[model samples]
Target: MERDSQLELYQAVAVRLKEAHARVRSLQVPEGVRMALSRKLLAITAVAKHDLARAARRLDRLMKDLDEGRFPEGD
Candidate 1:
């Protein structure tokens, strides 16, 4: 509920996402399926990475605003 807690939650999620992304990148598919499915898998991972990045940026902005004493309009 508070800004500090919210910021910590966002940072924890971002860290987990990054770890998952790295694990996915390091996965090795069987040679037979790798040729057929690699591209699609890579695309999916790319989208996940992009979404995670966007979320991190938004969280960073929110934290900055909180630090500057600029509370959201409604709260």
Candidate 2:
């Protein structure tokens, strides 16, 4: 996918996850509703693990890019 497209997809997922989190936080709900919401929240919480795995995978790619002498000057 193109970089722009990939970024758009990421943004969409982020918005969805934020909304889900807010839903988990703001409602006074029943036991069943709370249980279901907790499960959904747990799935969102797994994003931290997913992010760590992704960072590990990309560490080499990023290091390679840096070693190739690519740098952005601070403005």
Candidate 3:
């Protein structure tokens, strides 16, 4: 129960951090800076999406292991 709670807290923190980063990244800027920021943000979003896809894959693997009774407790 404690571990589950901790995981939830960590997830919440991760979400908040991402949100804060996005907000900061959205700040106004000069035209040149805005263009660069837009490109950089696109790249960052692409990487983030790739990372999220990988995380989903890992979660699916974990679910499969759980279903197969392969993952150890406290893992």
Candidate 4:
């Protein structure tokens, strides 16, 4: 596949990941589980957010590399 097409796909995935992260941030925990499991849930959510952020950063770097003609050959 061509580099431009791969870059577009990366951009699309990054956008979707960002949107999903926003949705996750906007979610409310149900009242039933809020008292007992809230901390655990929040911790898990934090980890997920961190991972998503890392992925987004990597995607941004990839896009930049592609634009600058710095992408490694045979990638």
Candidate 1 clash pair list = none
Q: How far is candidate 1 from the true structure (C-alpha RMSD, Å)?
A: 16.5
| C-alpha positional error of residue 53 in candidate 3 after TM-score superposition, expressed in Å | 27
Which candidate leads in TM-score?
A: 2
Off by over 4 Å in 3: 29-75
Please give the ranking of all candidate structures by TM-score, highest first, separated by commas: 2, 1, 4, 3
lDDT for residue 32 in candidate 1, whole number 0-100: 46
Write model 2 residue lDDT over 1-75, tens digit each, in one string.
677875765565565556555754565655566565556455544653466334333433433433464433322
- In candidate 1, what are the lDDT values of residues 1-75, reduced to their tens digit? 677876775567557545534543454544443333334334434544556555555545544543465543221
| Two-way TM-score contest, 1 vs 4, winner | 1
Single out the weakest 10-residue window by summed lDDT for candidate 2: 53-62
Off by over 4 Å in 2: 44-75
Q: Candidate 1: lDDT over CA atoms?
A: 0.49
Q: Judge candidate 1 at residue 74 and give its lDDT.
A: 25
Over 1-75, each residue of candidate 4 has an lDDT whose tens digit, in order, gives: 677865775566657545544543454544443332334334434544556445555555544543464523221
Model 2: what TM-score? 0.44
The segments of candidate 4 whose C-alpha lies over 4 angstroms from its true place after superposition are: 30-75
lDDT of each: 0.49, 0.50, 0.48, 0.47
Q: Kindly report which residue pairs in candidate 3 clash with one another.
A: none
TM-scores of the models, in the given order?
0.39, 0.44, 0.37, 0.38
Stretches off by above 4 angstroms in model 1 are 30-75
Of candidate 3, the 10-residue stretch with the lowest lDDT total is 66-75
